[model samples]
Target: MSTEVKLSQSTAIRLEQARTKGMSDADILKAIQANDVAAFDAVSEEDYRYDEFLSYAADHGENLEVAVQDGYRITFNTRGGLGIYLEKAFGVVAEKDFAVGEGIITGLKLKPEQAEVLAERLASNWVITESKDVPEGKVLTLKLRALV
Candidate 1:
């Protein structure tokens, strides 16, 4: 017995294009099976780009300690939160109001020195809100938001 799988119009078009580029059907099927191209295609453009960025960061030894929700938020560890902190702080200060930026700096608990470094980095990004201290051993909360 044999099973037949129908390809969607987009996928059919892609297969045709691959064939035109001299990719044999067996080669294309092998590539698709090996790489799970369907899964890759299902990922949103933004998520795909961010994953690529993370890979690049890892390659450069800047391994970002972070958690990502694909197309939503990216929560960075205290050490990696400086960039977002600065971006948010500058936005709030420039608006002349105390509005927290889209990203935040929160974690289990940061050392005073770690917090100071984050504050300084954020300050260099421009004006920002003051850093807050977290209680020791407090569980960090993750609030996922939709990407703008």
Candidate 2:
């Protein structure tokens, strides 16, 4: 008897890349099981952006998850952080609370770049606002209203 397993697009691509680099199937399977594979090894640009979070997880040996509540609450594990250039740039604390308001200006406080990246990735209808008088000189707040 034989058993077959299906792999996600990203995983398949990674497996192929690893094979091309002379990694045996057994070695690849062991590495994957141990969570010790390099994220960007032999991956093309197209697959890399397919799901940015997967690359982050593979890189840090940690998982990143996001939760949305009522289309307003946007929270994610910032373990590996977002974006390739700014992994550890911001000092964000875990479980940070951001008030949910209906166009009343209340949400997560993030750097302008960080806010935009996260907002765009999470939803297309997020409203981002920047306030400079809030001690940080220039901070962008992320607010989600609806997914319409």
Candidate 3:
């Protein structure tokens, strides 16, 4: 088998151990799948853009996803916790988040034009996540439920 698959298998085994240790179904899955939705702390925080995005959402708000950012709209479901993670590990797929910012502006009581401008700018920055200063050991983090 390929190295990637072998690594995945190893990770899955570790996750299974955790699952047997009385961890939540979600946490176990998050550890196993290691895919987009399962992008949690540690190694995941290192590479995944969505990992950083999810962390940002906790401080700013909840419900982070793909497509929309800054103020939430249509986006991916990277925030679904362990359910998404488990499905991915088993090779099962899930629906992505899809709520356009159509009425979000009015919903948030901001002017539509103003919201549009903000969205445009935020989307621009999303491509280039402003890196944070990482310490020696801690590094940056993903703020996954498993960690907290």
Candidate 4:
């Protein structure tokens, strides 16, 4: 008995392009097997481009995380908390506002002295948590919690 893996149209096009560049079928299959899907034993309908997101973040030297509390209320948490903080503290305007109940912004370029001030200012109805020296001092992940 044998099984077949159905490649998406994009993946098929990529395979053909690789073939035109003189790559052997074995090598192309190996590359496809390595990247076209995750290692789980399940079929995927579309590519999520997780690799692309991570690669871009790495190239730009950014470590960001977002968390939304369960059953968060827009009326209580408000929608523009993080945006307000970003604009006031760092003189940076958020490209978009966070969804209600999704009130945590984790990546910011902050100096050690500035972290305390940021926490204090956002403390009104919001909780501020800091993580430092993750793997090294080069990266920081801030976890902000909002009361809803």
Off by over 4 Å in 1: 36-148
RMSD of each: 18.1, 14.4, 18.7, 19.2
Write down the TM-score for model 3.
Answer: 0.18
Summarize candidate 4's per-residue lDDT along 1-148 as a digit string, tens digits: 0222222222222333343445555653454345433421122224322334323333543221110111111112233544443444344445432122355554554555555544433434455454465332212333434332
Query: What's each prediction's TM-score?
Result: 0.23, 0.28, 0.18, 0.32
TM-score, model 2 to reference = 0.28
Better of 1 and 2 by TM-score: 2
Model 1's alpha-carbon lDDT is 0.32
lDDT of 1 by residue, 22-130 (tens): 5555654454445444433323244122223333434543312211101111122232243323223222122232223344323323455534433332222232234
In model 1, how large is the Cα lDDT of residue 42? 29
- Residues 1-148 of candidate 3 have per-residue lDDT tens digits of 0111111222332333333345455553443334343433333322232333333444543322221122222222233422233232322233322112211111112233433432332211122112233232111112222323
Count clashing pairs, candidate 4.
Answer: 0
Q: Which ten residues in a row have the lowest lDDT in candidate 1?
A: 66-75
Give per-residue CA lDDT, model 2, range 1-148, as digits (tens): 0222222223333333444546555655454455554533543345343244355445643322211111122233221222221222233432352443343234345656655444434323344554443554344454444522
C-alpha lDDT of candidate 2 relative to the true structure? 0.38
After superposition, which runs of candidate 4 have C-alpha atoms over 4 Å from their true positions? 1-79, 93-101, 133-148
- The full ranking of all candidates by lDDT, starting with the best, is 2, 4, 1, 3
